[model samples]
Target chain A: MNFTNNTYLAEQLKIGNTKAYDYLMHTFYQKLCAYAYTLSHNHDTAEDIVQNVFVNIWVKKKKINPLFPIKNFLYKLVYNEFINQYRKNKPVEYLEKKYFEAVDTSVDNTTKNIEKLIKIVNKEIESLPPKCKQIFLLSKKEGLTHTEIAEYLDVSTKTIEGHITRAFKILKDKLDTEGKAIFFLLFNLDVFSEIKKL
Target chain B: MKQVEIEKIIVKYINQEANHKELEELSGWLKKNENISIFNHFVNVEYLTAHNMGNYNINKAKAAIDVKLKANKRKQRRYQIKRFSVAASILILFGFVTLKYLNFNTANQPKELSKKNNPKNKAILTLGDGREINLEKDKNYSSKNVVGNSKKLLYTQDNKTKTNLSYNYLTIPRGGNLFVQLADGSKVWLNSESKLKYPDKFIKGKPRQIELIYGEAYLEVSPSTKHNGDVFKVISKSQEITVLGTHFNIKAYIEDKKIETTLVEGNVNVKKGNSEVLLKPNQQSITITNSNSIKVLEVDASQEIAWIKGVFSFNEESLENMMKTLARWYDVEFIFETPKSKKYLFTGVLEKTNSITDFLEFIKATSENEISFELKEKTVIIK
Candidate 1:
């Protein structure tokens, strides 16, 4: 009697289920906003970019690929919006073009595979020592100096430095060489920080 | 440099705010691995990080979205009712989109009315004695215990006849469908270009069996409780479906090279050769014509039975397949002038009540003028 999640989402959306749209929005809204902010900078503009992306998604719900996660398409659309805004406001730079090309889809499929990197990266991070993890989050997410992190944790600066060294070693050692590919694709610090909250 | 300090230098380099000592160390690290290129962002990090994000009013945005979606639902529901139908009038609903047939006969009809070739409810009924009757729309004809009306054909059994089973064949041509209630009260709807052969009346202590020679048929089997525990069995070209009492659809068009039975309610067992698969409600059993193996998978049963409700609902169907379906219902042949037209995929619910011309126009519109249709006699030329 119960429909599977992907099929259910498509069928429900066909009849205009606001709850499915709501689930999609709430799950990806913040991440989309953060991505837009990286592009447009202005929060109002970022919100506008993300909102427009979602409106397009809602209008095109019938075309959604239920087999794959919807977030990948959302991310791609946000990227396209960023490129459009970039073209309007500034001249093209080679370094910017190269990095954008790094995300390029060689294949015809619009849905690119960023697959399973989030879970693997999260698991590797969670495996860090509690103090090391806390210090690591403070340093990368807060963009704090070691001395500031030391003050925040009530620890010596040298101890804070040691925790950072140990955290990187554990992450690198646990995931090994394969994790390097994952590390490259999902290199955004803010998104990982948001995951840490969850 | 000590490895611990090297980590700090790499972090500073990643942030792109490293001084001379760290920059030199990062170049050394880069030499160790050539793939460390993803870290560099050419844009000004200060501008990206310091940009103001205006406060977003969550309540207002949600309310605005809610209103838009509600209006779409109301509009879609109204459209579904107003524009929906299938290829057949006697049987189940059909198709992907809400379909309305396109009529090609636009010229004025003759006064005599018999000369007109307009659409009418028609099918062929072959009695057990090899006598064939051409059935017409809304005409009442009773041959022995069997009664035929424009809508459906009904068979009533005589209790004390003690006669053996007499098989009768009903063929619904490409332009129409046939709905028939068996002597045992089982109801069946045959799609256009389909043929069903069943016993005229159920003999006591025998299992009810019918054969779908070709095309599609949706059947609701009468419960076994009334049949003295006799199971109903439906035979398609490639597979056989056995059920105690249930509703299901079998699409076994010989041209498609695959026979599929989709269960709508209760459990049904599909058998191909020695391999048998049990299907739950909303599950489908697929049997390829050349293979004995049957594949079972879950599906939305509503899509399979949509034909009975007069909708040709397609979920990413190729143009060739859709054209074939239309060809059967409208009793027309398709001539493809371009090979690319076959590869085009469509997803929509088109009503069956629409004319063949309208359906072709819809396809042409969806293809953005890349495709156009011309009706020549009984042939539809696609260019």
Candidate 2:
């Protein structure tokens, strides 16, 4: 079947038609170049980045989502390619420094609220015994249910329940002693629930 | 009331297996006890899969998850070869410059290096009067001194009797690519914004000399039988570099304020004013700070010469430095929106043919930089 721009081109690539691959390359060459240039700001590197992305798309055509827009997929692929290229020759620690710096300032406002709640929960969770704290984190922060927690911890579900109960009780009493601590507890819980929805 | 019963119900609820009454009863109990309410919140939040609880990157994890999803959606072996091929192509391209440099040194040089390599690797010829001519495009023109061979472009006087050929200055523009065939069939590729001044043709018994005013250039010098100590000299702002028949690159960008000469193969001696420093393959000599002293460092030739292959090379280059390179190639002006924004540096490789937006998106993926560009006339303001 004939395809249009990115969609048809991506589809044509999937079926092993070499001609379709060429068509896709010519069409997306400039678009990919634009995206790559946006990242490195160097024409030479930008060209390399786009070339890699196109090759990757051709190779991973079958894995690509048919319904997923080709342009979006290309954008994502170009981004991932740059990250991969950066990591290969760069020291991990040095690379992480930029990563953390880039992340620290741009946290989404919506995520910030959840993060604040998680911070509070973590502080209270830390008050628990080490095992209990771990259990609580795996359950509350990691979203593991009692049975899954038992399976992961290799303990009985009853024991897993003990950890959660103890962890919950400690947080409850500490917050209650602080007066209206229940609200804090609820807020933290709400944050977790909100995260699950996402 | 036992913990086992509560645990059972929680698991059932998490699995969405709880009946209506069970759900109501569970909600009622959570409302009554603060601790149970917190515990229930965790269940509601699906904490078991919290790998994506907004703690990590959703898009990245989603991509990974997509890989897992694809395993279930289709056969894996079918795409394996294709993936491998794509990876292979990149490795080949990534190694293209190094391979070309090495091949140019050992293998028979291509009849037309310009056809095999982009003009970015070739050098430009500058007139003494300040007019720059791209030597690659002038292949068809026959001058008194310069001529193009199968792959080599040469500049030589029509008569050995002539001591001086017409003096011309050649500058490779920043982000601009060019090629030149020397008198002895050697080929040189000039990187962005570099200027070179040399004789239109070389006369016998005269040492071959070329001046590098600014920017980077790569040369694939052809070997000769006379070997009359046929020396090639590159005079830069800070130092004078001398080399025999070999493959190497000289970068003396004006804005960089430093002259860098990298040897990919063979040997060269860099003279920083009065001081002399020798360089070997994969070695870089730098004369910096106007001190007129040179420092030699061992380095990867690919990192230094990727530009000649039409790609960018970064060794943890700062954002400001990266932008300067970008500005030259894209021929745009950069205005940083935030203070100290330009100081950011990252290690990455990008090709030199993509548009401005492509590079930005590639870097934006690695870091959290909100970038929006405003174009006025021809300048780009990054916000």
Listed per candidate, the RMSD to the true structure in angstroms reads 15.8, 20.1
Q: Write the per-residue lDDT of candidate 1 for residues B1-383, one digit (tens) a residue.
A: 56556666554543343678767655655554333432222121211222212234566666755665565566445445332233432211222232223223324422232222234568888888899888876678898788877569988867865557788898888868878999889999989889999998877787788999998999998999888898998988857888899999999886889998999998899999999989999998889998999888889888788777777877567789988998887778898999987866666676667666656666765566677988777888989
Model 2 — TM-score against the truth?
0.46
- lDDT per residue (tens digit) for residues B214-290 in model 2: 77788776653354667777787758877777788887777778877889998888998789988989999888847
Instruction: Score every model by TM-score.
Output: 0.56, 0.46
lDDT of 1 by residue, A1-198 (tens): 123366676667657788777776766575566456545444566666677676667777678776765566777888776665434324555434433443342111112222243344466566778888788767655557787887887889778767775665565454345445555555776688889999
Model 2 spans with C-alpha error above 4 angstroms: A1-198, B1-140, B147-159, B223-225, B368-372
Q: Cα miss at B34, model 1 (Å)? A: 20
